[model samples]
Target: MIDARRGVLYPDRMPRFHRLPPMPEAQHLVAWFWIPEWDLGPGETSRQDVVAYPALNLVVEPSGVQLVGATTAATHRDLTGRGWAVGALLRPAAVPALAEKPSELRDSWAGLSAPDLLEPVAAAMDGDDDDRLLRAVAIMSRWLAERAGEPTDAGLQANAMSELLMTDAGIRTSEQAATRLAVSLRTLQRMTHRYVGLPPLAMIRRRRLQEAAQRLRDDPGIDLAALAAELGYADHAHLTGDFRTVLGMAPSGYRQEL
Candidate 1:
């Protein structure tokens, strides 16, 4: 299972962010929907840190619609004012359908405009919150349904390979990922690098670090040394180093924030 709990970085602010499962037919194309609404006091600015998965997103915000691509590393978005957003998180296999070279979109986003599915979604944006979200996602679903063709055999297998690496903690390291995918290590690396926007090890590390951050939020009192070892970190210092490097905060400090 893709652990939803481990996807977002700031669990303490859960009320401001949430995700909904995509319709079954859209699962192969869209992983889920992320909804974030925030009201900030004057002089208040909040930064949202995210350890994104090997996927893309269609984000609709107060500004406009944007097709957010896969990110090669961790990133943060600074939030201000009172605003809300609805986003469709695309799956790894869905990248090629949207962009020929997935890496071209890595860490970058493209703007969207009128005359697409955004019309209805944009029109419904001013209404009640629930209705707005429903109308928006429904239109998006219809749009994706038209292009939800099954990916190539290798793409499908690559998605399956990513799934195992992300969801199963037992499968650590690229070698383990190759074993799970029943492919040679070199083959898995090549496919993931070409289609997934990152090497298998990098993607695996991203998911692992996200999971670690979540655990820190959920149980701040847990032993960092044990947690580090459990998560395959070389040592306690290793865990802190990764936390600081990726999230810009030490693990202990992250837990304290929670």
Candidate 2:
């Protein structure tokens, strides 16, 4: 399972959230599917803070469907009343078909005219049953598979680039990622920009920052300097700068909020 809560800053404050594996039909196009259902009383709202993963998301809400682009920094959303959202965290192979220029869509979203994808999933979500979420996800997955079709060779290469940059803790630089993927530095740069809307180094940094935040949250007694070194930051100050820039808070201040 993908760590559903890894990108989420404060899980304690989240509404009912479920992260599920993508259906076999959509595995190449989607990393995972996520759904968050919330029901609040009058005047109540839940604020969700997230240091989102470096990927696009196709989201289905009651009102409509939207293509959410990759985010460069931490972001948050406010939920009110009764609502739920079903989202697919898209893979690199699936990007080109859905978006023309991903880099332009950074830190934002656009409404999609995909009622063929939305109507059935929405109906499934509206059901009153134990299997509603499952049914909805399956419907969404099938639609994505059909709409995106199969990825080409270059698309698969983009997928490989993202995998290396986001995982492989040993990869701390774009050059290292290119070497591992057997691609030129320029190719790596173009692939990420075209498919992911972020640079290879940015993806690497996001992964490191996410891990640092998780460590601070999970192990309060952990030493900051040591954690920074372990995650390949040059020093404590580098890690602090990342936290301050992306999350808008210092490590200690984040820990204090817990």
Maximum-lDDT candidate: 2
The residue pairs in collision within model 1 are none
What is the lDDT of every predicted structure here? 0.76, 0.90
Candidate 2's residue-wise lDDT over 139-223, tens digit each?
9889888888887899888877877777789999999998999889998998999999999899999999999989888998899
Number of the top-ranking candidate, with TM-score as the measure: 2
Off by over 4 Å in 2: none
lDDT per residue as tens, model 1, 1-258 = 687666667755544776777766677767788888788888988888778887778787767788787776578777777888888887766667666766767789888663576666667766865666767677776677666575668667867876787888887789988987788999988877676667788778887788888887778799999999999988999888888777788888888777
Worst 10 residues of 1 by lDDT: 6-15
Model 2, TM vs. native: 0.98
Cα distance off (Å), candidate 2, residue 7: 0.5
